[model samples]
Target: MSRYAEYRALAQSLGVDAVALVPGPNFVRLMKQDFHSHERPLLLVIPAAGPVAAIVPNLELSSFAKLGFEGEVFDWMDQSGYAGAFAALARHIPLGSLAVEGQVMRVFVHHALATAFPGLKIVDAEREISGLRLRKTAEEVAALEGAIRISELALAEVLDDVRIGMTETQIEGHLIQAMFRHGASELAFGPIVAAGENSALPHAHARDVPVQPGDALLFDWGARHGGFCADITRTVFVGHASDEAQAVYETVLQANLKGHEVTRAGITAHDVDDAVTGVLEASVFADRIRTKTGHGLGREVHEAPYIMRGNRQLLEPGMVFTNEPGLYCIGGFGVRIEDDMLVTQDGCRSLTTFPKGLRILG
Candidate 1:
């Protein structure tokens, strides 16, 4: 909720003295083009060596004021010519060194800001800001908890509807309906209803096959509510899973559980990954591992501190993410076991609790 504070901390890290923000989301949030307000445009002014001030467009004056700002305000008017907006904004402070979110900010905005401070030092500020938001706050974790509840309920209903001869598309419809019924405003991502061979794709979102008896069904889905998201994946086998299918399923489940055992406060994401990697190597399905051990899931479905090779971010309390270990065999059946987790002060707690043991669906 406080993207400003995160940027302020970044400004401090970059040796800046103060910061400023210009409203940049007039086209999206105000225009109804996008539903997300967090992605709306905003300008951050950081004074690395001294103090900071704020300058905003006339149209954004009230919006900025609503932010309950405590610093100086330089309102820019644009009723006249092309330079009015830029000039008015530029009139706020004498430029020295400024950092902007180059990765997330639009190119046009970057160009305009650069033009206004041609003589001042302009630097890419993405890493600085992203580092500040790597940790989750209490309020943020609460929102994610709600999202997880809605999502798990949806999953339970989806599992209940599983029957032989149903197409993947039909399963997706039931999932969407369950999500809405459980309180999701919309899907956090497309509900993956892959059956048998489709499950081998890992990220297959298209649903186009009938679910037959004794086939692997992977449902990778999430739900969005109150501006938060939940991510979870679960795989099941229809009645009479082949020996290969059962073996892969059990191996994936063991890898998932092994990885979960190592997730705790103070543990690095790489540590958790290595724990699972060890179990995967020990198991016969080691060669079948096809994806990362897990990933951080909050705010955006995929965010900071991802569980991948060489990521050294320590698992901190209040952090929420996913532990989804998957195994894929080309042309053969694959399996994946996933669940949403919240990092507690001591260890991690699962948010989604639908039965994960191998289920033979018919």
Candidate 2:
């Protein structure tokens, strides 16, 4: 079978004539190359039972040629625009109904296709298309491990340097530099270095506010290496911890541990989240719960098989996801412990090894 067999099968299953791809995780996975998605448009079309085709930018022809793609290339120039190229592709393949990555493709490209192939049917297959990456291969797991190793090293360095009174943004600067120094190709996302009450916000941004004694310092960050991503979050207390802070921290920690204990192949995603969230729901801080248990993690930080209530997707060996359980009290503080988990035959293994026990920092 050709490499396009799976995609063609997916297209046929989705009841679409072809599947269209833009520059994103799915694109990079199949082509083994990355491209910038700017003003220019680049597209690849795979029909259910025929040869594939592409509309390439004139400038990218040389780079696209390296992929050894067995298809017709309809190249277009900047001055002339991509309409002609899309028009040519329309004539070549004559697609009736097509599947597309709704999250990645831009409106301009959709409009261009609609204009070129008038009366064409475009179906948003974001979930079906991205679901292909739900499971990790051995090689992909190695890349994720490399990313997590670099992130953990950087976090350790930042914690050692974190003293009372340092601004949140200052600490963020230390983190970004340390990730590169420890050998990271790129950041998975902007690092979150919220301090004190700011930590109460699940996705808080670092600010100029100085860290104070008896404050919660939260760091949610990761590094991207070898086309894979690592997402880990650790919350530490600066100086002394209040009685309420310690209670909340311990509660969140237990909930995180529960996620590790219940995950395994053959279990449903809902089961894991229910077990993890149950611990928090039974706690005195139950009202403090602000988010779901976690999300699937891989080439993109968030993907399919979301760990939450109402999702019945079964966990399978080789699937990886984040086991993050957090509790937030708006205007007071928050505590969250996140770890990347790989589902195995018997159970799950945590990819994050940084200590989870409560620690007091200077």
Candidate 3:
């Protein structure tokens, strides 16, 4: 069934008059089009039974028309204000209770929608909609794999230019340039280039501090390909590795591997988090943990099926997420190993192949 058809069925099951989408990933998935956030509100409503309708800005009519929209379109110009468009859409669709992206739709848009249909109920169906994009198709997995390969290659190229006197920000520049040179369409997120004390800050902003000989330089970054993303982290020594650093690295590496080992169909997300965190809690570096083990990764850097404590979402085939576990010691050093994984029929397969073992780089 088409995505719209599937959504219509879901809305019918929930007894909602329609399922609405705003400008974001859900819009991209259903419409195969990109819509930017503007002062004028744009909404696409797929009723339980009828054609899909939209409330779009007059300037965007051409863009929306390209979708070959099969229903009525209520468009208003900037000078006219959007209230008329909302009212026209309301008159056409006529809602009882409409389902919307509770997490995404803006309050102003909601108010406008409520004003158009008095006594209208707006139900949150974020889960039902987001769930549609949770499991990736074969094409998506391949695109993610391509993105990971480009990210790894870019890191390798930048590593050749890294030296002791270079600041973290300088290294970030080198990495970004390399990512583009290596054919990455876009970056999943800003590359994290941290060293020494800065590395202890899990989500550290790259600073001007010169990398030292004994510093643990943590590099966390990803690349985008075909709209899919890959997130990977690797912590390497600048010149020499200390015993303490090695121990911490090994412990975190074990936790990362444990996270992968415990991931498979039928396993609860909490179980995987518990098993991974268990590996660290059993060690003396337990207090070093500063963040959740990992998070879902795909079109957006972070999505559904987050890997954290108390989440009961089950692992399923085609689901992809990160398996990163880190140890951070304030004013000391930090180590993290992150790899994207795809849940398979039995277990999970790592999408990133960057060596996890300690690498001593200049």
The C-alpha RMSD in Å for every predicted model, in order, reads 4.5, 0.8, 1.5
Instruction: In candidate 3, list every pair of residues with a backbone clash.
Output: none
Lowest summed lDDT over 10 consecutive residues: which window, candidate 2? 296-305
lDDT per residue for candidate 1 within 191-227, as digits (tens), equals 7888878888888875667888878888888898766
Q: TM-score for candidate 1, please give it.
A: 0.82
Model 3, C-alpha of 58: deviation from truth (Å) = 1.9
User: Which pairs of residues have clashing backbones in candidate 1?
Assistant: 15-48, 16-47, 16-48, 17-47, 17-48, 18-47, 19-45, 20-45, 238-361, 239-361
Candidate 2 structure quality by residue, lDDT tens digits, 17-44:
9999999899999999988969999999
Instruction: List the candidates' TM-scores in order.
Output: 0.82, 0.99, 0.95
Query: In model 2, where do residues sit more than 4 Å from their true spots?
Result: none
In model 2, which residue pairs have backbone atoms overlapping below 3 Å? none
lDDT of 3 by residue, 1-362 (tens): 65589879878987999999999878887777778866779999999988889888999988888987778888999998999989988888889999998878999999999999999999999888878888999988998999999999999988888998999999999998888888899898988999998899988899988888999999999988778888999999989999999999999999999988889989988888899999999999999988887888888888888888999999899999998899999999999999999999899999999988889996
Off by over 4 Å in 1: 1-6, 16-65, 69-84, 119-124
